[model samples]
Target: MTANEMTGGEALAHMLLAHEAGPIFGMGGFQLLPFYDAARRLGLQHHLINDERCGAFAADAYAKVTGRVGLCDATLGPGATNLVTALVESLNAGIPIVALVGNTHRLHSWKNMTQESRQVEILRPAVKEIIRIDHIERIPELIRRAFVVATTGRPGPVVVDIPEDIAHATYPFDETWFEVDSTYTAAPALRTRPAAENLAAAVELLVEAERPIMLCGGGVHISGAAQMITRFAEAINMPVAHTMSGKGSIACTSALNAGIFGRYDRIANRLIDESDVLLVVGCKLGEIATKRYTLPEPGKKIIHLDIVAEEIGRTVIPSVSLWSDAREGIADLLEVLPQDELKERLAKWAATVATRMQQWRVDVAPRLTSAEVPINMARLLHELNLNLP
Candidate 1:
């Protein structure tokens, strides 16, 4: 292939390789042969899976594990449709993936094509964007845009359909088209810190409360603020309870760990009910986490910290809302706190929560033996606690 006369297939393969694409998972057919040949020439490793659906799933798994755009390919019609289920999963799970599908040639396009339908329209709803390439020259631009859309705000999948005629057509490789600016990074706006007066009011509530519990959520993991959470909890000696996804936000083995808070454990439910104050950090207070917002009595105070202000007071109205990065908010609160008083209160609360947890375990122990298989809640909790940090 001459430098200025590279085939569309070669250009597509080069662009994907430029992005450092690895082991593309997909099923192959005659329509996609040119693209596969190009990939082989470019030394881009191909992961040939048994079915197109599995290929899409493997691609989703790859993206989730590597934090990069996953790649999958399929031939026209049925092959493309087979990937729909896995593509939907990737979309819901917020994974970045690229689906490349082959299409009938331009000359044969409208003549009752055997393996051709409106592939782009069918996939439009399930992906970030869809680019149907009828011309060879548009391949580079389309590929670049696909990556941009797939990995951006609330990342999901994108689709690129290459007509067989276009794939075989020759075009000059445009190096500049694939060069993305290094400094362009996706950074969502962090939440702003609470005002001094608001902070003071929240602190007052915590200081006066006989039982105060700290609840952590997925945002802690997303913000990489687990250590900050641990620091804040330790500084106050407060009992730490995590939502299922936030299990590792604080070391589960820590003496201050009060176990998961939600419908999962009776002790957790009791702790939420009895606590005078709740410090909700990075948790959205979603229905799954709060059991449809069946919270404690109306008089209890709640201090909620989250990156998005709307998430605060979502399920239950919070007494104080700190719209800020969870890590930064916790750090700021620690700075302004009466450390001695907070520590004393935390120690007392931890002891109380721990005792309640032990009693809960004892109470649930009998329920396990009621069944022939035994519903081992304690064992499950133990296993979960062991797996968590």
Candidate 2:
């Protein structure tokens, strides 16, 4: 082997490092030993896991927190299968993750090879895409494609299957070939904005609405638009409600906060029912968010904004659909809003929300201090909240 030549495992590690993908999680096995060894030599961070499922979950959490494409790995058959549950979670939650799986040698596959089951078929439904690298020369390109698929447009997990033979094959290295597209390294890679006409239409509805609310979903957090959404809601004095996954889209202490709606929620459901116009951002208004698809009630005008256009009307049809990245859409809405006028018009509503929140706090106050035998969950939660640093 010459300096210009690199093994498939080395190519995979080099490309991942070039893309700054790190803190990988997985339990290594014989089929992936070369890749693991290359990862170690290349100083790529790897957190050893007892199970592949745990690694996938760790990756999911990492993506949720950092807005980056999380990376994980697995060996053949059972190891690959173990990632299904976590992959499905990432798919549904729209978190970006790139999973690398080892495979039996291509020559030995289906010849009664150990740990050889149709892994690709098993993982197809669990991920956005499953890519198998049949040729060693394509390792860098395929790995690059995996990241692109995982992080782009609605973000989800992508699996890159590397047969043992492919992992060990050698190919000439070209630094330029290993260079990664910077765009696909993180979630919401494109940050697309809605059309000017659509944004204008949404603004018109919000301006005209007598009782307007903003409902945020996990997309706010995923797009790193929490701060933008918070600022927009506060500026217009719009009462903001959220689904469970959108908990931190705004500060819990914000005066405009209406809390979570739907099952296992706070005081937002009633507000949603009464609102004349609902501005939903980043949320799909799924079953849990809509209380089995019944909240928001019929006859209410809705302005829906999201990265995925298809989801805009999948549940509750939006009167005005703004298809864009959460942050970009919120920024545009703020840009077009008649701030001074909106604040003045919404003052009464804001006051009402404040009053309602005060009464809610009062209603739940006793539960926070309850010292009953086993102790109420609310009281325990309050205690924990007070004690946590």
Candidate 3:
């Protein structure tokens, strides 16, 4: 064989390394043994998981934490089926993952072969896209496509099903085919800002409103917009609230931070009730975030910004919807906002949030210090908070 020629498994491993795809999580099986051997030989980091579901979940967590595309794999049949729950979780949370699933040989497909099942059909609904590899030569190209699809736009899991025969099949490979696009290596591969007209309209509402608050969600974390959001909130003197998943969008100690707003919150709901205009960024304002769709009261003007257009009006219709990445949208708003004109008018709202936050801390102080035998949940949380870096 020529130096450019390699098996499907070797191509997959080589492409993964070229793209700098990190830490693969999976449980090995016969159908994927060649790829596993290739990975081992290539010095790729493979984390052996106890179950396929756990592997998928670990990948999901890796994506969430690193703001990169997570990688996982499973063999045919039961192994592939086990990843559904975690794939659904990643889909709903907008996390990026690339799942490699092994399948039976093409000849045995639909012939009642052992561990033979229609995995693409089974996993379609659970992922953003699913591609089955029929030709060994397309392995590297398809792997690159999977990364692009998984990380770009509204990030989610993509499945690439490789048949056993394809994995072991040798083919003439071009060295140029191994080139990967570095842009799609991480989540939020592209950043987009809102329209100029939408930002102007949102600014008008924000300037005139006596009470305006911001609500953020997981999109803030995905876009790595924490510092930008904090700066924006501070500049406008606006109170900021978060969903359960959106916690830590802003520093907890920041006076503008109103804490979690949802089914179980501290002071954010109170602020939301009093707000006249709501600036929602990144969050979907789903049932949990909106307290079963009963938040911001009625007739409150809303300005919604999200990377996904479909999520903008799915729950609560916004007066202005900015379909853009979380960081870029907020950066554009900050750039155009008339900050000098509105400091006096919004300072009172900021003061009110700070006062309420202090009062809430006082009210919860006793509970946090409780020394009950079973150890109160609040006390446990307080201890954890103290130790957090």
Ordered by TM-score, highest first, the candidates read: 2, 3, 1
Off by over 4 Å in 1: 1-4, 103-111, 128-138, 181-215, 275-286, 293-341, 366-389
TM-score result, candidate 2 = 0.97
Worst 10 residues of 2 by lDDT: 1-10
lDDT of 1 at 273: 83
- Rate residue 136 of model 1 by lDDT: 83
lDDT (10s digit) by residue, model 3, range 75-113 = 999999999999999999999999989999888788898
Estimate, for each residue in 318-377, the C-alpha lDDT of model 2 and write its tens digit. 899998999999998898899989989998987777789899989999999998979899
Clashing pairs in 3: none
Q: Pick the TM-score winner.
A: 2
Better of 1 and 3 by TM-score: 3
Each candidate's clash count: 0, 0, 0
Candidate lDDT (C-alpha), each: 0.77, 0.90, 0.90
Candidate 3 segments exceeding 4 Å error: 1-3, 387-389
